[model samples]
Target chain A: MKISELSECSGVSIASIKFYQREELLPEPERTSPNQAQYDTQHVDRLRLIRALVDVGGLSVATVRTVLAAAESDIPMDWAMGVAQRAIPGSVELPATTTRGVSEIDTITETLGWKVSPDNPGRGMAARVIDSYVQLDHEEILSVLPEYSRAAMIVAAADLASVGLQPSRMRMSETVVVGTVLGDSLFAGLRRMAQEDEARRRYAQVQS
Target chain B: MKISELSECSGVSIASIKFYQREELLPEPERTSPNQAQYDTQHVDRLRLIRALVDVGGLSVATVRTVLAAAESDIPMDWAMGVAQRAIPGSVELPATTTRGVSEIDTITETLGWKVSPDNPGRGMAARVIDSYVQLDHEEILSVLPEYSRAAMIVAAADLASVGLQPSRMRMSETVVVGTVLGDSLFAGLRRMAQEDEARRRYAQVQS
Candidate 1:
């Protein structure tokens, strides 16, 4: 298929396809002539994945490139998952002043009996939230950490189960990356709705 | 405290404090002179909240203004929460082509016995994710919606409980808004860690 057809089929623009190619996020197509190149269903699929990462996951182009490279690599699924998670925006090192928050997260992970690596970017990211709570003097909010951890374990199990349902290792890898990214958005959205429902149940006055 | 003292206390730069004032994100301080203004503890607290919304919540200055206004208003906490959630990015109305996806989300909410409003931006956001799955031919991923919904309920309960712990209605309103925003980041970070642990448990080989 031509680039235009790729754009039409994949719902990506031609210019973005070219930009992605230049960024090495998309591989070069087979040249049919001096001025023409052909794309395949794989290109379409890749484009869709890129769009999901960018649009839904809200990843930067650089981060999207990182995720795509990890997804395409022949590494173990867990390692690839780690790469994808680390590539996310907030998964950076925290300041030294956040030791208390980091320790609190360590306690939560330990209490959950989950063997998360000490260096998992998620640890830092979660600790950063804890640090924010501490900074705002809202330490009472930390009381809900256990519940959040339990719910996260449940959701992570579901996430892995969903990935397991994919038919191929390649598909599973793609699912792991896409699911890790989009799953956050999905859960966050559902959570807002659920929060509203819970609030209504607890606080809404019954209509006379 | 002067504006510089406010900056020193909040750790926000002098320029950013002025910018927030210009953006109306921060209220004008009591002018001590033609070029000097006095800030207070309230100013410091508001600055912290603004930073949390902008930095951790990744909300725009416009959205931060919306959330601050909602939090400060003499409205019910749940209503304030609605405003905050709606102001977040990706909470906008989805395109009309997403009816199928929206209905799928409706079914999930109904299954959960959650009375979410049809206009809830979360419903639209989650439906957009569903549409992405459909477009990518990854409907198998939807199998986990029930689990995701269950997990969301658990987390939402925690979120509301945390809000309930606040000592004042004003604090509760702030927590409701701040929690709704940062809770997503908090949960996403923890979910990544939990996913890693689960991946290790399911896939890690026995090290000799």
Candidate 2:
């Protein structure tokens, strides 16, 4: 089909389609002409996933491409899970039910407490959370995870963008590090602290 | 204090302070000179709140301003609770206690279930989550909240995006409505249904 049709089908724009092609997110389809390229349903699906990753998932094109390659590798879930481990150490082994809610949160609080106090209250909370996990049904708990994941990414992206966070290398590094290290909450927390800290200064300067 | 001093205290840059001043997140400070403006501690606190709402709370600047104004107007906690009926109607008021434990989680789940669903599996799991919540003191629970809130905002924002996720929006709105009216698992069952649907899609997509 035409690139226009691809754009309409993918809900991405014609210009975006061209850009994705350039980014190699969309495979270069067999071309009938120098400018016109034939696209297919796979292109649509791949672009859709890319759209989900980049637009909804807020992954960078390069990152999205890497994830796509992994998905396409048709690698076993084990390998995929292995790759995921780097982002979350125990997540691959998380009871599918509890991966949605992992020890990471407790880990987060523990980490914070370690930083701020020897005994952080968050530390205990994480424990109860893990114990509770023993009883939750897998499918039931796993279901909420996508919502949690998507929400975190979406908000993080919006926050980053709102701040005009730049120097892609620095910003992207921050994104990866925060997402990996802080387990969601602190990732969200630090940014909020920074933004508020910044806003407070500005508000004071403006206000008498 | 001068703008520079305000910036120093607030930890925001001079430019952002000027911007917030222009945006009115801060009231106009006393101008001490042709090139200087003065701010106070009150200004500092208010600016801090503004940043908290916008950055931590994921509120837009306009929304942050409105929330602050409403806060000034003495919007009752009950009123806000009433409005929150959709997300969690039957749910009990957030526990006043900063510290919580498994028993508290059980109580909240039971109380919430009475109004929502008695056999709601999610409630059971939420109760389990108490174990996790219990690990930390109140601050830790709150620390997790910003992450949770950001996650919610991400989904809300994503729904607003996604071309015409009108259906997704409608579903969420209905969830709110169900939460408000049915105040039960009516909406939750719907959420479970969505997960089932997503699972089906995943299965089918993988096969195809």
Candidate 3:
């Protein structure tokens, strides 16, 4: 099939198809003549996958190349499954509720799995945020839009897996990168507003 | 002290302090003379807090305004506590783990907190990625670390937080905006690669 046909079938633009070919995500078509390049089923399928990741999953071309290479090895999948079994790999989970007025130096040192400074001003807050998240009851999270949030994450995860599941080493290193990006960007944005709301309440309490 | 003195004392650049002034992150300083503005201890402190928010907390200027308003309310702090109690509000929390193969339609519905068509082709894959994340275990994640990979996020988060938190609201809001932009750009790039990787893996898995 021609690139145009592939583009229509794959729901990707003709220009994109050519770009991917250059990026090597789409294999260079066999040249039937100086001006003619013939693509086949494999080309079509590759384009389909590429389109899904770029358009739907939102991965970059460079990261896609890395993930493509990583996924090629059965070893990577084995490692990913292994990591999945232990932790989501590249992530830390924290609870939202806790009386732990910011973790002390020791707590941060331990949590960071390092010997970070004890009096680092920011360290306390970071530890506090982590502690708050860790201490927060799972139910607490549920109390806020109990059904909707999980549904979104789960669906996004599935979409992510369908796009590629070869751990994070490929494509910027997996769920955490994507998750962190989204969490910090989307959810964190919402959370900041929420914090402001909370801070407002705190101020009001002081005044009263 | 003049505005320049405040800048020097606070270690904030003149340009940034001016930006903060323009953004209303700082109250209008008393004008010492027609062309000059006089700053004070309170202004110094406010500048410090503003630096924390913009440089440390990583929030945007707009968010900083909201947060600042919250902090500056005439309402008593005691009254603010009552408001803090309500800050969490209600949110949805679906099953931490998702069923495999839910459609892209379902994924979109869930993310947007609305309904979507199941017949959509990409929906199924979308659900899988999120499910896989929910399914990841702590150990699995730890095992996948490439030497020092385990510490990278910890370090990044710590540094990222420090940059904007000292000024509290202004810096914090800027940090959050940076996150938003990063998500919009970086994640989109990575997801593209993921889709192709998954397709190739599935094909190879079946073939073998």
Which of the predicted structures, 2 or 3, would earn the higher DockQ when compared with the native?
A: 3
**Tens digit of lDDT per residue, candidate 3, span B1-208?**
8877888888888898888888777889898689988888877777765554554335557755665665457545423322222222122233344454243224334543422223221133333334443443212321221211112222223323332243543333333333322322222222222222332444334433
lDDT of 2 by residue, B120-195 (tens): 2233333333433332111233234343334434332322222122133222222222222221111122222222
Give candidate 2's whole-model lDDT: 0.40
Off by over 4 Å in 2: A2-19, A28-38, A74-208, B1-76, B80-208
Docking class of 3: incorrect
> In order, what DockQ does each candidate have?
0.55, 0.04, 0.08
lDDT (Cα, tens digit) per residue for candidate 2, span A99-164: 423454434434423221212222232333333333321122222334433443344333333212
- Superposed by TM-score, candidate 3 places the C-alpha of residue A113 at a distance from the truth, in angstroms, of 7.1
lDDT (tens digit, per residue) of candidate 1 on B1-208: 9877888888999999989889987777888899878899878878887877776567888878777777778776677777776766657576677576888998888877888877887887789888878877778889889889999999999988887777765566667767876678789889888999999887776645
Q: Each model's TM-score?
A: 0.79, 0.32, 0.42
Candidate 1 deviant stretches above 4 angstroms: A1-75, A87-90, A96-98, B1-77
Per-residue CA lDDT of model 3 for A29-103, tens digit only, reads: 989989888888878766654544444336668756655555455554533322222221222222254434333
Task: Report i-RMS for every model.
Answer: 1.6, 17.2, 15.8
> What does the lDDT read for residue B110 in candidate 3?
52
For model 2, state the Cα shift of residue B67 in Å. 5.1
> Which RMSD values do the candidates have, in order?
4.7, 20.1, 13.8
